[model samples]
Target: MSRKVILTCALTGAGDTTGKSEHVPVTPEQIAADAIAAARAGASVVHVHVRDVATGQGSRDVELYREVVRLVGASDVDPVINLTAGMGGDLVIDPSDPTAQLPGTDLVSGLERLPHVEQLLPEICTIDCGSLNFGEGSQIYVSTPDMLREGAARIKELGVKPEMEIFDTGQLWFANVMVAEGLIAPPPLYQLCMGIPYGAPASPGLLNAMVHLLPEGAQWTSFAIGRDQLRWVAQSVLLGGHVRVGLEDNLYLRKGVKATNAQLVEEAGKIIDSLGDAVATPDEARDILQLDRKAGAA
Candidate 1:
């Protein structure tokens, strides 16, 4: 296609994948190291989600984010930082007692979710565009319309680009709503997340349909979990969109071979190159996303 594809590496997500793969980064230091490695391996952007060092579970501790950002800042490679502001929205309900929230439920207001974004001021941060059943459980990732409006305003005020995470078509609908209301800036960025749970499935037809729904001239990316991760890199790029990969979405590079974040980035880079396309560099990505170099980058 001869297009410049912006590749992102999601270092570690909040999922329970630590035990499944030893390559998943848990501590801030590990996450930072993996991010740098991914950058070196040709990822223009590094998506971060901090985990508790003691348990390998996801955490929203500002200090953890602070440390990760600091480590990345001190590193030689200066990849565009895209921190996850989608935490504190897990609403795990008790099946037996619907009124009671389970122990893992970390529901908080929209403003409460952006503490790290506000404090750290990364180049990009995500906003879960809507609520949905996250998995095969009673838990829902809460991102109501009211909550989105409030969160969008704060993210705008902080001058951080919001990577609108669209799990389903409905979330894409509300994300357009944010754009219509002038909450989101011009050239809104959307991440079409597929194959998580009871949400959008990872299919080319579905990905194409969602891509059609995006606003004209919108900057968008698409990714699928598990085996679909590497495949979607070609799918998304062929459809004229960006791509994301790494341990957060999938662990194994192939059948029985666990992959690190850098390996995934390298694989994606190869995929882009095989198609006669070039991988976008960090500076090119920053310009494409209109990130403020003075404020967002280190």
Candidate 2:
């Protein structure tokens, strides 16, 4: 483990996990505080997704994102913020009437999904590379090719790095197309998402294949959901990539143990240490990801 691993803490995802863990921050204030804590606990980056405080549902409100970024900027610890641009893509189809959309559908244009990223201009924002079957339902995570191109252009225009979220190999394939098309900037960043329903499963062979598919010199991190979260930390480090952990991907630090974002980050740090590597600092992460240190500043 001679490599310096960049550890990212996904502060609070848009998943329906708030009820399962008290540590899942729903409000802007709580999410910001959790991000700060994760940075203090040895995370070089914090990936964020805002939630509605009243309903505990994932929100696309730019106001909430503004507040979260404002609060994180005000903090002493300076972790590179990675805002998620993967929302507003849920298309829950009606089971009986397949043509009709259900109540949870939030299909919007790619540009519409990136208002917060444009306004805040965080160092990094995610662009999910393709659509997904998501879970055991009629739901789908829509990210069409045209949509991705539009999102990638906007992200580049904002001078923000796009953490291309690849759920399957097909997504990775299309992402390379974007890179070739000059939409994704040099030294593209990728997040190899695994272990979700209908996406790539948490398999060592599959992870290796995905890594092989990445463009040369790409900066990447990999994560799995639920029980495989911590396991994937070591797996990612061994594969010569970075690591992501937090309440977003998993709720437990161990069996029967609920985890806070900070706790999850600490565990990831320990895993990195055990592998004979050190967790990267914010400045180091900036260099590795080819990002400006002050990119997020207003």
Candidate 3:
């Protein structure tokens, strides 16, 4: 019997990719539509991040989240909804005046980032493990220890599983500390994010090391960005972990071919199948991740 692997399709991330690829969904309806399409294409879960309608940048607005969730919930297929709590952590500062925040800064208390999670009570939400120099320029993604602890506790209170987003090895270490401190529940879910600017590079050795560091009995998935997105699916499965793919991480299916979220999920399914593993259904994914099925849908 082949092992079961859960595949997550991250629709539209908080990045500024709308202009680069017209496929990046900017509205709640489009994002939700992509989620449904991905689910039909064999994705066990759909990780989501909403963008502002006017600016096309990531937004922490609860209304956007609510609309997306409602649309997906009312759809035919039911995939596990994993809402992003990774927003509201961006801190862009001026180089000359370090005391002054730049135009892109959206820093807020960790708890403030969970308003949507608190309202919807999705099966799973993210807790970015630590802060990082997000990308080029002075932009920084901030998620301190105190903030993470508080966020984890609140998510726990809401009875939602927190998917710890590990961007670097150090972030993984801090996540382990949280688990040791009895903050994260047993069989914690981890998403090893690789190939982002300055975070853990997209290296098999580095990924293997990170996998080995995970606590025993933990369920985890690993993904890389851009050209490495598809390749990382095979790498992750070989290492006894699940996989993630979609427009949020990569836009092109090949050299110059832009892919839709469903196309990405279908390609990832083929990889898992070729590796002699079967894709887990949403209910199967729920069992694997120890998540309770949300009411309605399917």
Candidate 4:
């Protein structure tokens, strides 16, 4: 019997990859089109992060999220929608004055990051589990314990499944604590984000260790960035987990070759098929994740 794998395409992350890859969608229409195309290409879910059309940087604008969600809902394909609540947590502090925020800072409270999630009520929304020294700079992604507790409670109330974004071992530990406290519902969903700077490296041993730490009956997916993106698909599936791929994680399908969101999804599907595992359909993914579709319907 073939294992069913849920493939998620992260359309446009809150990263600065737009300038590097022409295929990275910046506008709502482009993002939605990519989501529909990815679904057609065998993606079970589309993880979305809206960008500022003018600056090409990530934005927490509810209007942009609304537009993308509306467009995807109106389309023929019905892939599961997973909005990112990972924004509004960037904190770039000044070197000289620790109290002074830098130019790139976009800090806000946890609840402030979920206006779009609250309005659109997507089936799944991301909640970055903890703070991190993001990338190679003074930038830090802040998500305190109090903030996470508040956010998780609200997400539970909204009936939107929170995909806990675990960047490191400590984050995973905290996530398990949340589960122990009954903050996250049964079959808690997790996304093990690897190879992103100071967080957990894209190592197979580490991934396996993290998987072991997940609460029993947890649903999880794993992904890596750059050259490891495609390879991580197989790694994830082989380890009894789902997979994630898209322009947000990696710009190229191969060396010197750029990839579209649909292309990534197609390649991931082929990998799953070759491994004797089938890529789950959107509906199958819903069942696996135990999502309440009607609760998230707009």
Instruction: Pick the TM-score winner.
Output: 4
- Predict model 3's lDDT versus the native: 0.93
How do the residues 13-125 of candidate 3 rate in per-residue lDDT, one tens digit apiece?
98889999989999999999999999999999999999999999999999999999999988899899999999899898999998899998999999999999988888989
Relative to the unseen true structure, what is the C-alpha lDDT of residue 226 in candidate 1, on a scale of 0 to 100?
98
For 44-143, candidate 4 gives per-residue lDDT tens digits of 9999999999999999999999999999999999999999999999999987998999999999999998999899999999999999999887999999
lDDT assessment of candidate 2: 0.93
Poorly placed runs, candidate 3 (over 4 Å): 294-298
Name the top lDDT candidate: 4
- Order the candidate numbers by lDDT, best to worst: 4, 3, 1, 2
Which pairs clash (backbone N, Cα, C closer than 3 Å) in model 2? Answer: none
Kindly report which residue pairs in candidate 4 clash with one another.
none
Candidate 2: tens digits of C-alpha lDDT, residues 51-169: 99999999999999999999999999999999999999999998899899999899999999998888888999999999999889899999999899988998888899999999999
Off by over 4 Å in 2: none
Cα lDDT for residue 32, candidate 2: 97
Candidate 1 per-residue lDDT over residues 1-298, each given as its tens digit: 3778899999999999999998999999999999999999999999999999999999999999999999999999999999999999999888999899988999999999988888889989999999999888799889899999999999988888999999999999999989999999877999999999989999899999999999887999999999999999999999999999999999989989999999999999999999888999999998888886655543
Worst 10 residues of 2 by lDDT: 289-298
lDDT by candidate, in order shown: 0.93, 0.93, 0.93, 0.95
